[model samples]
Target: MPPSLVTIGHATFQSQTLGDLQSGSLNIFLPGLNLGLHAAPTKQWVIVLAGSIKVYLQNNQSEANTAFVSSGTSGILLVVDTKDVSPVGHITETIEQTALLFMPTANGTVPEHRVLHNHVCAGEDLL
Candidate 1:
């Protein structure tokens, strides 16, 4: 499906449905905190609200393989890697005081999206 523009009032906006969310939580982490290698409990949307963090997969935690995201659309990440289907998890390290928004979906369902980059959204996604 292609994205279409909808005019709500005087401005136009792109509208799309991700998925049915179960619940949401706010997670705050201190600087220099390494969450270590882990996988998401379920499928969810992770949004960096503040500061920055480096995320790497369990199989690869190198600086180059790490995925970096900040606060905004570019920071949106869909975590589908679980302990059941996949053995690989992800690692998170806080460079500063980082606030993350965790929105878990129902029954580990993932949203429909085309990844701009490897695992994270690239800047070109805004265009």
Candidate 2:
């Protein structure tokens, strides 16, 4: 049987008034979506809101490791040591699609919550 559709809500973040909040701008990954192997300088956190997927990592010794992540699951906090951190294996989704949130860790900086849709006040709805 196919997996049921999950209703995942977006998170809200605190931003300056001058900043505009973009909604529905999230990138969705369908089944069999290949996010070609790539690496960054800092560590990254990937949150899966829906569906499941497999992840492969290559070590310095040319060795590779694999990990599985389920729906509503999160990937390990990985710090890329080199510039070309490529996936040694493939990631296959167990479900139809997966929703993921990716954030990079930096110098004393943290990821913020972002709402998917805008919420208007009662009186503002009339405008």
- For all candidates, the clash counts are 0, 1
Give me candidate 1's TM-score against the actual structure.
0.83
lDDT of 1 by residue, 1-127 (tens): 2356889879998765658999999999999999877877888988899989988866586665677777866777778888886677888889999999999988787777665555444456542
For each candidate in the order shown, give its overall lDDT on alpha carbons.
0.78, 0.42
lDDT of 2: 0.42
For model 2 the TM-score comes to: 0.44
Highest TM-score: which candidate? Answer: 1
Per-residue CA lDDT of model 2 for 1-127, tens digit only, reads 1123444467454322211222222347888765555454344445566766665554222223444566431332233333543344233333448776555554413344343322211222211
**Model 2: which residue pairs collide?**
11-114
Error of 1 at 115 (Å): 5.3
